[model samples]
Target chain A: MVVIARSALGKLRGKYDSLSTTEKRIAQLALNSPSTVSEMTIRELASAAGASTASISRFVKRLGYANYREFTMELAHVVVVDAQEGAKLFKELGEGDSLGVIANKVFHSSMASLEATNDALSENDIARAVLKLINAGTVNFFGLGGSSIAALDGYHKFVRTSLNVAYHPDYDIQLMQAAKLTADDCAVVISHSGKNYETIQIVKELKANHVPIIGITSYSGSPLARAATVTLLSLTDEIKYRSEGMYSLISQIAILDSLFMMTVLRSSSRTQPVLMHVRDVIERTREEP
Target chain B: MVVIARSALGKLRGKYDSLSTTEKRIAQLALNSPSTVSEMTIRELASAAGASTASISRFVKRLGYANYREFTMELAHVVVVDAQEGAKLFKELGEGDSLGVIANKVFHSSMASLEATNDALSENDIARAVLKLINAGTVNFFGLGGSSIAALDGYHKFVRTSLNVAYHPDYDIQLMQAAKLTADDCAVVISHSGKNYETIQIVKELKANHVPIIGITSYSGSPLARAATVTLLSLTDEIKYRSEGMYSLISQIAILDSLFMMTVLRSSSRTQPVLMHVRDVIERTREEP
Candidate 1:
């Protein structure tokens, strides 16, 4: 039997075919009522599933848990993650949604997107991006329309580090900046669709110049994703007929934040003094009033 | 006694002094061990507090609960809210923090800040700001340095709505824009310190022009807080010797998000079509590739 750190429900479904008739009953009950089964003891679960306590004990072990307690704990965690990831229908902005309802929905959606993006991100990509950023002569951020906010944010965060970074609000200026970049420089381009004309233009320019491009976009199959040397994806719920990509901004920001933190930590010896100086500047300005 | 919807722990603390000696002992135990008390049955609590079951029943009623069950449910809610508000020490990035640890800490801190900011927000302020924005001729966002990112974000969000909004990256340009505003316009100013020289200059200009200023700042006692017509506060944990107001950006963005959501919903009649059009544009552009 292969033991793995998997969700209880996942394990139950994965191994359902191989289980005994009595154990299959328990697995069915658990899959059907995860929250209820999570809160149940071994005796309660056994009775509910028409199985015995000994079978319940053996069942949890089969799911890679040492005992029932660990199984329940993992189930509880899955329940929370499921709720955050919109396992239930996420309420969209309706005609008569209250202020409190709107606030809750937006916050929940943002959180869900962050968790999804984090799950999709690979540690290897993050490490590679950090290395490229640390070694780059300059970092340029490219985005247009709605994604410009995220591009500007990336520039803001990276400016705090000991790296030369650039972002421009004007599309033509950004294109010019991209054309001037060399192979020694790096670019972080953001587009939720990853297929914007201007965004692809900048990506082509960077590619022609042989500059390393780290693309942040929602679609893994996007043209920008293909053009970039490395791609980081941001995920949002599949809400049809909604406003423009609002939730993905939070996910994109999270990806940038993680990359920034990694870069700072990886180059702490070089960045510590810079960060301390930034802190001092902030402190002095704040204390002035 | 007057009854109200308050946290169980709040009620216990509020009435602790007036309780009888036996009830005071129960109160102390409940206050000190809210999570434990919430999980305990009436008999369990009585024994734990060295009191009788009758006293526990009476104590809950005094706290405005119909019975012990209601009181325990409210206590459980308090525990969850307390956890969200940073009652437990949030893990900070240490010198030797791993990439996974750094990522988790940043994501958790951002979520915590959003929840805290949401809790601190008053619905009335949101409603009023939305109304002001709807009625205003133009909405100008002002922030310098670290807060410029938030200001830009505010601009990005409001620009999606059916309203006129403006923001500039240069401090002098922002000041000039502020000087040109009138009483019919609105200014949404952001400053983590609420004391930056350029930020205060813009605030003064807005104040002199009698424009309605909506200030978002960390400190409630700063000059910007006092100068603004309405102030919305963003709270973060008190961590000394850190970078320049990084976590507060998440809280500030949350505040802006709430305000934006309310604005869209409150004026859905006018903004709904605009949002749909924006969505169409995004869709059209995304399909170009």
Candidate 2:
């Protein structure tokens, strides 16, 4: 049996016809109430599904899981993802809606975006991206148009860390900056659609230089994400109508914020003194005479 | 009796000692189960409190509410704000936490900040800010350090609208830009601390120019909020530790997003054509043959 890490329920349904009549009963119980089945022990599931313990063990293995425990864990993940998706607020704003209602919709939409984006993040991806950022000669942020705001935000944040960073609002300068970066440097490219012509142009330059690119984008199959050494998605529930990348801005910044926090926490020893020095300089500059 | 638009439960507690015996019963019921009291009609509340409906009406009047419905609405607001505050994820990050745990904390903290900030926004304030933005000859964005990101974002979004928006990353340039604004212009200044030295200087310049200022800050009593013609707060639940204005960034951007949405919605007829024009320009700039 091929062990696909995709949806466990999908796998069960795909191999449903292949199961024995007794195993099909167990599969029926799991499909009917996956959440309930996830909490049931192997022995309990057997009694509930009218199958023997040995049959239940064989049923899980047939579905490509190592054991009942692994099967239950994957089912639990599906439950979580489903619950998260179920809570989506894809509400549309009406012409006569009150400001309070509009504000609620806007805030809830941003929160929903943050929730969906956060759910899709993996620890290994974050760890890999942060490692590259930490070891980079210069962390160059490449973004254009709406995404430049996120890029500038990344620069504003990472500049405070021990790492050196660079960003420019002008697209020409950003392309030039990307060309200057070598393999030792890391490029953090951000785009909502993940397929802007100029953004791809800069990504091309970074790729030619063998620069390790950390792409933050909405689409996984976009040119930027495919070319990136590490890709992080910034998902949003604002698909009903395009508000010119409104909700995506919040999700993108949040992804960067997590990266910033991780970078700081992981390298606190090296970053602490530099952070303090930066704070001291700012305090002195802002102090009253 | 003074009608305090503050917490309904707080008002009930404060006036508990002064209530008549019959009124005290209603107050006790309200304090015990505020959510239940909020849902109950006047007759139900009176019956639950073992009092007459007339006495319940009198009790609400004594509490400075005009009617039973108004009193219930205030109670509902209290319930909502409490629910929002209770949902706050103020969990601290430990050194041994995994990257996934850290990302969850970061994202939840941001969502919490957005929720708290959204709860504090008033419709009247939003209407007033949008009116100012619409009527102004130019809308200039002023923010330093952390807030400049929001200001730049505001500029980025507003530029797509019909409004002549301006923002500069450089502090000196921002100050000069502030100085150039006359009474015809409107300034939207963002500062997380609400009392930054250079931000105050820019605020002072705008004041001297007699420009109407809209302040977005954490504190209502801060210099920026005090000096502005209209003050809109961007609250955060990140008070436990000094994160160098980490969570505030998300809240501020969300606030900008809300304002942008309101502006576009309110002035869609005027902004629609310009929005389409800007989109066309962007598309052409990023298009390839």
Candidate 3:
């Protein structure tokens, strides 16, 4: 898992902006005419963008690629993944397409997010957190916005597993609850961006009071991550559709749900029997008058 | 696409309870010797439950099956599709299973929902309502709770086109907004279940005012479906781990989004250029100083 330095991201963003008129023209043309530019050599790119080959070469270096060849490879990667500048805001989703096509696309995107998540998770950190959870007297969860759904889900899955778990959606009460926590208690906090001000304050208060904090955020360099004993990441490809990416948010919640279910079952022997009993009850009860 | 009558489900539940003594015997044997039970025949099932073959036969009928053979066939279906239920929860989720296995299960469930939705949708009703939308001078969307997110998504997509659209998340504001509508306007109401009182009230008020109504709900026979000029069924599977089945909900929203987008694009030729220009401006601004 390559930990992309914040500085490197900043450098790329900056250099991407600072391309002069000729270089900017070439870059824009590459972004706009991806198929044509992807097939172009340096001279062709210069001709297409109405720029000099030397300027295109300089633009390649500015993006931190070794040479035009590496730069073109990166361009191809971005083009394949994210470069849809002129695609209509929405298209009539085909009724003609088979269910399998729709499902394949949906699951492909979900698996991509899951892969990014695995890349971001640290085994050592997760092990340490699991050890703490195993030793803790109780686990308290805090979340807000769409994230509160994940917290509620965690609470639901963990409650039946013989774990002393507590969660509520109200933010003020959550903060008050966190304030009452002792060192023996564990707090799991989930926020997508990790920069929501109220969430940060609650986390800060927890840190001041010395509670074990488990953070889950997509961005590893977030303040929430710095305050945590362990963290998990939920990744999303930039969702192209509308107001906010509500679809991707749920997938993130599913990941958290998966974690809670896994941890609860692993730490206790009670869940298995309970589940077996439920299944048997459901199955057996299906045979009556 | 078949509507399972509520009374039918209730009767099924009653019949399930009648199998109590036999279920207990069967559960006991199955728990004690799962492999033996798995290998059992009709004679074995009858004996294991400590009931006669006729009783086992009646039991299958009670559980909504035609016969014991059909019951076993359904059980086999559950085994293949839901093998995870046999082994505790998280252990199945975290196992070294192929992606194809997961994809097959998830896709099969989603397809079932899609088919149900299509079956419940009335083509004649939808055509009349779509014609209203195409011809309307104004369209106001009123929804609250989870429905508000979908409502807002519709509004966002439609506003970019030539149509006059309005949506409010607050309940009082939605009522007020509904009050402001006239006979020329159309209202789209959405709910997963048709039972939400607030939505029903707003729909009734809109009715009194003679505003055309377009409804989307899962239950085709419910009040919302009956009240609307058109209803599009949004189907979902019943799964233990899924509370709202948020991923499935996204499919419903995407359907609405596709409709809204297509409507906008259909109206004025200006929309495509506007969308394309918006993307270009966003890119150039982000790329520039």
Candidate 4:
């Protein structure tokens, strides 16, 4: 695997001539815009290159990479290494900073997280997740500790739509709920670290039941990412003292927010009445002012 | 009261000659940067103008405004009406849009929300909020429906700190918790509309119990904001089709993230051990890879 040691661009150039029609289009896209391509998910790359995700997966394997994740990781490494030769990343948060400075840094980091997470999403992946959510008999949300908040948020947002959704703040109840989901249901499992023991346990249960999963996390190669039917990454520029999980929380919610919007818009007819009813109920709760 | 009909800048200038020394400094700031000053919390204005928040509050009252919130609202109104005469807001999401387009719109809206929310925050407000949290016997989080997600997130983040924190997803439990809080405790209340009956009920309970409230909401005049000891607004450029609550949620989380970052940085000595232990526990959960 000495070929792995070569630059991603160099490897692409070396393998471009021997590629198939669809694979050649993917290679052309990679060569033309390595930086943009580096940030994209496999489904996004397929859409950009007008190729099937399967073909993109096959193309990466043919390039002597283990999987699509590896190919993109190496490509991102190459692009970042090249770009950072001149460009500097963001500043680190320190103890002596004032409140205004802290607010600015947090907001900037969150904006960057949203941008990077958006860059990695594909139309196909979102469509798939929406379809699964809309057609599922029940949508169960799973997360533990810090991530349970995001799971609960996903449940809260989707409930306004026509979907039947469920979430529990308790880990034991979450595991039990995961065990109840079947192939007909969908699960949105959120974990910043992606390797949390309890979250992986729930994932295992869901997988055993053949439930489709939409994993939202920071790592691309974690167990959750590999096992998910469709994975949506929540990325951030990690810096010391600025808990990476905090920014990932913002990115994860943004991803879920996008999915919620897309689902609501795509199925407006089904969601409109539900939304109106919910709004009316909420209005009734308001004081007459 | 007819003075209210005039632009905020006009009001500021009219009252400038009558203000005391500290109040003159506040007026000068409002005149020099009406737009920026419009977005600031009173604490922020105090810090920027080198005056006490009490003086800034009294200054606004002397300017014919009933309160600080009204003063800032009028100023913001003047600034926005002038700026928006030519500049258009963002595009609204539609059913016909592709997933990628939806992702783009959502991310853009979330980013805008963060920026506006950050603009509204004053270092003084954050410092005050942080100080309240640190000194409180227990930090309680209150919200309902959509806002409960933020409340839960606040609990999750603050629990990681050294402070004692509590949150409940049930409205009844939250109300009960609010009632139990006293002047020694602090409540962080989140609501997008700030008019939700259950939230206001909880706010009433907290007020009756004499607990200091940090209100996070979109409307500056909402009951939550009016009653809060320190009001931090979460703003967004609302569009017709896009759910305004969704963007507000993003803004609320970013505000919390900033507060969380500030608390941890300011009290690193106290929180350092807890963070290290949490990190170790999470690391132990990782698979040997």
Query: What's the best-to-worst order under DockQ?
Result: 4, 2, 1, 3
Off by over 4 Å in 3: A1-178, A184-186, A238-247, A259-289, B1-190, B195-216, B219-289
The interface RMSD value for candidate 3 stands at 13.5
Chain B TM-score against the true chain B, each candidate: 0.71, 0.73, 0.57, 0.67
Give per-residue lDDT, candidate 4, residue A122. 57
Model 2, span B88-133: residue lDDT tens: 4456876677899989988988887786677667666777888999
TM-score of 4: 0.70
* Candidate 2: pairs in clash: none
Q: Candidate 2: DockQ?
A: 0.24
Model 1 lDDT per residue over A209-230, tens place: 9999999999999999998889
Please provide, for model 2 over A1-289, each residue's C-alpha lDDT reduced to its tens digit, 9 standing for 90 to 100: 8965668789889999998999889999888888888767889999998889999998898888887766776666566556545765546886576666677788888898999999999999999999999999999998898999899999988888899999998999998898899999999999988888999999999999999999999989988889999999999975454365667889999999899888888898998788778767766655252
lDDT of 3 by residue, A52-146 (tens): 89888888887666677545544443443333323422222344433333333333444344434443344445555666666677888887765
Residues B179-212 of candidate 3: C-alpha lDDT, one tens digit per residue: 8787799888877665577888888888888888
| Whole-model lDDT, model 1 | 0.79
What local distance difference test score does each model get?
A: 0.79, 0.83, 0.58, 0.81
Please give the distance, in angstroms, between residue B242's alpha carbon in candidate 1 and its true position after superposition: 3.2
Q: Higher-DockQ candidate among 2 and 3?
A: 2
**lDDT score at residue A288, model 3, on the 0-100 scale:** 28
Cα displacement (Å) at residue A229, model 3? 3.0
TM-score of chain A of each: 0.68, 0.67, 0.59, 0.71
Give DockQ per model, in order.
0.23, 0.24, 0.02, 0.27
